[model samples]
Target chain A: MLRAAGDWTTASIGDAERAIANVVRQARGVKQLNIAGLGQLDTNGAMLLLETAELAGEGQAVALTGVRDEHRRLLEVIAAASVRHTDAPDDGNPVLRVLAEVGETALKLAREGVELLSFSGAATMAIVGLALRPWRIRWRGLVTQLQATGLNALPIVGLLNFLIGVVLAYQSANQLSKFGAELLTVDSVGVGVLRELGVLITAIIVAGRSGSAFTAQIGSMRVNQEIDAMQTIGLDPIEVLCAPRIMALMITLPLLVFFADVMAILGGAVASMFALDITLTQFAKQLQAAVSINHFWVGIVKAPVMAVMIATIGCFHGLKVSSNAASVGQRTTQSVVQSVFFVIAVDAIFSIFFLIIDV
Target chain B: MTSDIPASTHPLAIHVRGLRTQFGSHVVHDDLELAVRRGEVLGIVGGSGTGKSVLLRTIIGLNRPAAGEIEVLGHLTGTGGAAAAKAIRRRWGVLFQDGALFSSLTVAENVEAPLREHSNLSPRLRREVAELKVALVGLPPDANDKYPAELSGGMRKRAGIARALALDPDILFLDEPTAGLDPIGASNFDLLIADLQKSLGLTVVMITHDLDSLYAICDRVAVLIDKKTRIDTIPELMKINHPWIQEYFGGPRGRAAIASAERAGAAV
Candidate 1:
């Protein structure tokens, strides 16, 4: 016989559990729990006692002696509840499970790729249709988005490019100074900033900043049922939401890239003045001689393409958000990552094309 | 657990005196006083902007009243030390309007969270207790593995109740527990609450607009009027002369709820 006596409420369950553990270990052949001395009983205590009885009886049902009416009811409820089956513990081979996960992830990526392509096509068609019918375009949304995605982004973009320009010039000067060819630092900084780094860095920053913002904005709207409301009201979410953002990004990206080029070159000039004993006038002259307008144009040409990829991917993921708050966060993160990957891939393709064409 | 504490010796579960709550110059509640007895379900009802939720929030220490003395389970809430407040919080559980389950954790893990934080129970035992609580709340066995997003509204609320009962709390606070559920689901929820309260011997404070729930489960109704509380039984409250109180319990929906409650009583 096991006599359980204590306030078995949550407050004292910790101590009671310790004491019960000792009793259950010793009562190997016990078949009865006498709870007549049990003071206060709750679900937690009832569960603990039920477990104790099971462990003591070694998987057999242990009968209780002197159970009160209320304790009887409580124990019956807990006993029935304790019999529920939860998820089975995983005993599968780790290797096979990992392989399965890898394959599932790959399939998910491929499906997402196809969906994103279709969404891009739909958005492109909408933008083209709106461009042709200029009067039907939402000028207010365009202006608002342009200010939000462009004007607000200028300072961060400018500051980062300028800092990158300084770092590049300093690194180049360090290399060129070994051979007393420090004058060529101007050539390297001007050409690198105008041809590759300027637009690449700008596109990456915009992808992280505006791209994630687009996804989060649209994703939350999806979560809130605002997208469904818009559709029910006969408004095309693509036209009203996606088009303005894509159009504004397309218009601002090239201008931002141009701004980035100017800021980075200015930064390179300042670094050269400090590191290479070169004056601003000489730096300007060398930059003019080394970097041509086509290098600047090469960088500018990738801007609108990157903008389209980034904005479309962001909006696509946003539209794909399921009706939950977590989905909004997950989609937003995916949008930023995909947009950055595509920006670098498209930039590589542009570089190869430019190399083959010798432009 | 404290040596100085007298466990369950107090007659009142919650005591509030001179509670004055304001947002800027707009007063939501002023000089509000209330006392809740132990082991009783009290329903708080009010019209829009009458501070039903505000009073609950203030009492729970979510929103501190501008001036008030709020005591819950014999502990002075919001004015106590961190350890004291935590002890008080452990003795009670709150269910928000929505389940407010952590979106990242599954239902089983959501139920285990408090145990993981507060108890020294083994991992297996904690899991068992969480599953038992889930079962106790009438959620399916499979729901233990599912996320809150995957569950229906009613199921999510059930999961919320399971989490609230995770510690076998002395008091359960529910805010708008059946607001969005269908009529049948709401009645079932009322029954579930009534059953849990009886079995667990919990003191329940519920803020609800459901007259049926008030009529069916609440032992006493606390009506929020003129920024103060008028506490009475439903039948006694119905006989009061306040216009809002009259329109509330004597209204069509209120009458229907009372009629249904009477029928249920008759059947029982």
Candidate 2:
């Protein structure tokens, strides 16, 4: 026999549940459920009791005693509504399921790739059209975005690359000193910082900071239906929103890369002085002899291309955001990941091209 | 321990006296006095930005009154420590204006949240109880697995109510329950509240601008004006000489709502 006592309201639900569990577990072979001692039962408690009785298995003839009329109504309501069904199970083979999922993702990627190409074409047309009619460009918005994306990112990029330069010089000093060629640490630091690490780190930082900002701003606007409001008033969102940001990034990134290159080299020089006991004069002379002007130009020339990739991917994901709050966060994360990956991949291609042409 | 006291001895489910609420230099309410009796549905009405929703929030301990004594279910709100506040909170359930179900969890999981947090029921029993609450609010069984974003506006409202009723609290607070529903859906919601109130003997406090809901189910109407509340039965409220109340109750929408309620009564 099952007996429940005390208040069965929400306040006492924990104790009530424990009691019900104890009774149900011990009532496997028992038939009659007694509740004459039950006190202060409400709908939640009644539902729990009714559920326990239903779980007593088929043809067990479970009988509930001492139930008042009010509790009985609630039990009937719960019983009438307790029809349970499970969600449909997937019937396909596991191998086929994996293949189907891979195919679906590839198709989605292909579709998005085409969309990105079309957006690039449209953006190029807008840039050309604006060049022909320079009076129509929003110079104020362009300046503001330039300041936000470029000027604000200076300190962080400088500090990070400075630390990278220090670590590189320190490690090179350790290895080169074994060969009694500690002065060669300046050559390694200059070439590495000038040709690759400087521009690569700057691009990655911009993609994370400004690119994610672009996606989050536009994605939130899309979620709030402000994009539709803009279109209603005959404003092309791409021209008004995307163009200024892209122009800002294209103008500011090369300058930031130049700044990053200077900072990284200076950091390498400072580290060389401390680790290899090389004077600043000697470090400068070695950098001038070992790293050619071609190395710096190669890194700077890749800046505009990386800028285009980050800006376009950021704006593309922003415009692609669905009208849900969750989609804004998802699109922002995707923008950062995609832009960083593309920037690195394009940098590798540039490296190969420069190698082939013997730059 | 307080559950053993019969509900009737405490006629006032909610009591607020000398209440004052302010935000910066703006005062939303001052010297406000109101009381909600046991087992009654009280509809709070006012013009936009008149602090009807603020009053509900203050009573439920979501907002603190600047100066006042507010008691719900005989427990003081806002002055209570964490344990006392939690005890009071478990005695009532609140439904926000937009359903406010966690967007990530499915409908069934949303209903199961309070039960999981406050009880030790086995997984199977919790699932059963969640489904029962889902059905009690008149949602389809298939809606159990759907997200809040996937449901229609009316369905989301029902799911919100189901979550509110998950624990069978004595007091149910609803904010703009029928604001976005159509006339038919609004009346159906009113009927649902009336049915649940009768069956469960609930004390309901609703903030609503829907005249039909106020006319359909409210035992009394509280009008917020002049930075305070005026509580009375609907007929008595209509007899007051306040301009806002007159405009609200004598407005075209108000007239239509009253006519519809009369028609529904005559048919019944």
Best by lDDT: 1
TM-score of 2: 0.58
Minimum summed lDDT over a 10-residue window in model 1 chain B is located at B1-10
**CA-only RMSD, every prediction:** 23.4, 23.3
The clash count for each model shown is 0, 0
- Fnat for the candidates in order: 0.00, 0.00
Which lDDT value does model 2 have at B162?
A: 89
- Badly placed stretches (over 4 Å) of model 2 are A9-22, A25-32, A85-88, B1-268
Fnat score for model 1 = 0.00
* lDDT for each residue of candidate 1 in A1-359, tens digit (9 for 90 to 100): 88888688988998667877887898877889999998999999898888888789997778899898879888989888886557989869999999999999999999988988889889989989998999868787789889988999999999999999999999999999999999999989988988899999999999999999999988877775456434322246899789999999999999999999999988998998898889999998888887788988898999999999999998999999987999989998999998999999999999999999999
lDDT of 2 at A5: 60
Could you tell me which residue pairs clash in candidate 1? none
Backbone clashes (count) for model 2:
0
State the TM-score of candidate 1 restricted to chain B: 0.97
